[model samples]
Target: MTQEPKGILIVDDDQDMRELLERRLRRWDLDVVSAENGVDALEVLEREGIQLMITDWMMPEMDGLELCRAIRSRAFSRYIYIILLTGKAERHELVEGIEAGADDFIVKPFKKEELHVRIRAGMRMIQFERQKETAIQALRKKNLELEQAGATIRAHLEAAGKLQQAMLPLDVEHLGGVHFESLFVPCEYVAGDMFNYFELSDTKIAFFLLDVAGHGVPAAMQSVTISKVMNPLTLRARKAPTESSGEVKTRLLNFQDPAELAASLNRMFMGPKTGTQYFTMIYGVIDTEKNRVQFVQAGHPSLILLKSDGELKAIGEGGYPIGLLPKATYFAIELDVAPGDRIFIHSDGITDCRDANRKSFGFERLHEILSAKRQCSMRETLETIHRELISWTESATLEDDLSIVAMEFK
Candidate 1:
């Protein structure tokens, strides 16, 4: 990645002087390009890759200062090193030459070694200029490559995200006298945030949201596994028992039931704690026949119940986070769903969020959002919360994952 030596343009009207200077410089490995006057020197600059320029200040048509000014007017001229040869040795004359882009100068009747020193200094300047230009170009190339890679990866993730969304039961009719809704939003890092809902059986309808601990392709793959395991089981279960969501609520108002699904999840993923990895999830069976909602909470946030009359309740006894300890039990919580009530189930990313000041939005803030917007539709309430969440992080870049799901019972 090296270029030929910086072409030294020797501008002198005397042919003998030009040959002598050229011969002296050619003794070194430096490239030398000759011109008789400033006019010819400017042409050499346009036509040749001149890195170190040496011009006589007394040249006709364009003096050394004028040539320097013209060179300075161009972009990237800083990369070129210039040396002015002056007959006047006065201090002011030397200063004038320096101001006119002379990186170094030599007086008339100067020794060969003196000229050598001036050229050597100019060579060092050229070397520095070459290095800086090389570094800048390298950096620009890396940045462009990174941008392209990001675009490609984002497109693929977005496609996978759309597929994940389509896999959800988007229009499940309100069963068991319960209204259902679900939401998922990926932070820049796509993680194992997957959700599923379906009729588990004729008497019981099932719904669950699962969030894996990490992000990117690994989390996305885990999400696929969760979907494959749950969706089919849910579809088959619908053939068996029968119950309206209203019946499920009635039992929860009374007592608890060990959802068989909890044992299934705990068995499949929650193993020995040696890097025992799993996810947090909340699965609820809406038993329309019993009028109760039986659910399992595995290290997740408490479900928020927003009543139509403007009251908000945090449902579920928060349980141990999944995959933390080996064989940790993820138990189910029971809640009664009265008429005209709404329940919100979400990831901790919502309330545990922080701002620039590192302050948590917290459980209390979430409750307030729900209480204030109790009368709004589930969609509107979710939007309001999202808007506030964004505003909260305005002073800082987005730091974590966020999601909110609202379920209303009419």
Candidate 2:
């Protein structure tokens, strides 16, 4: 079905010329409005949805040029097709016609047939301009909507990041008689690496350093669920305090000694309500008086040990990750911690992390840097690792979540 014609405005000083043009345009079945001058045309435009316009070049008070300029200034309207009916054919006058917003020119005293053909031709131009304006409006509206959607996503991510942080130890200052320092850098705004600490007693502390299988937000969600289940306060104070890093490692490696806790954790995760996301992790306990670490492994990346005497080594054999393989075995290992020895646990995002060149910041290079800087304090050693990793990747930004947990026995 053909849509009705949108109103077209016609302006001229001569009543005869206006009537003649109106009669011909009406024959083509266009709804037309006639104005005696620019002032009348502006008023007609304000009161109506004018889609096209035709005006005479010379008129007292307001001319066609003045009308076109006025049309251009009003941005609220969609578009106006202004074809000036001019007597002069001079080049300078033609340019002026263009500046005044005349889309085309039609000579005065032309044939009625020629005039009819020209107005029809003017319709084609007006339609084209209308289509362009409509497209631009649509694109602008879509762009604004997309920007708002992006902003909403970012806000949610920031809130999630803060909540995950809240699950960790809020006070890193002199907890359980062991000085603790940590550096956690996620590839995204949030990451998969998670750690938790509970003060079981003045002499004994329980904690866990975990890295899920992948990186970014998905992996981060797994850690959040585990943290929720493993919280000692929430679990009726079932967990212990992490007096030292060595204790944390010792507890993680001794998994076979107590399947009860591991089994309970397994059942909790296996519940239908829990998400089916798998993750590799290391959980542990620290004994302040004994100066020991007890830790369990669940197919996580190995631990890096830095001795006070400048010796560096890796710990724990491999095991199956959590949230995968229903009946897998998990075992714990014990390691005696020395007064200046440091144990560093991290996610794959650190070692297998890629640069712009797609090269990994591998374990061999990491050990080399550790051996070189082991003579320094635990804080300096950890920071050196951070710097070397940054230097290896041409682009310092991580492709995955980067997390490094370092604990030194005081």
Each model's backbone clash number: 29, 31
Candidate 2, residues 1-410, lDDT tens digits: the string is 22334577889999999998898888878888999999999999888887678899999898888888988888745666778898999999999899878888888778878876767776776677777777888999999999999899889988998888777774344556666666677777788888766666777767667776666677788778777767765665444322254453113222223334554455445535366577777777778888887777777788777888877778987787766766676666787888888777877777886777788888888888778776666578667877777777866676776666667777
Q: Point to the candidate with the largest TM-score.
A: 1
- What lDDT is reached at residue 171 by model 2? 31
Error of 1 at 1 (Å): 6.5
Number of residue pairs clashing in candidate 1, backbone atoms closer than 3 angstroms, sequence gap of 3 or more or interchain: 29
Alpha-carbon RMSD, each predicted model: 6.7, 6.8
Task: Give each model's whole-structure lDDT.
Answer: 0.71, 0.74
For each candidate in turn, the TM-score is 0.83, 0.74
39-70 per-residue lDDT for model 1 (tens digits): 78778888877788887788778888887877
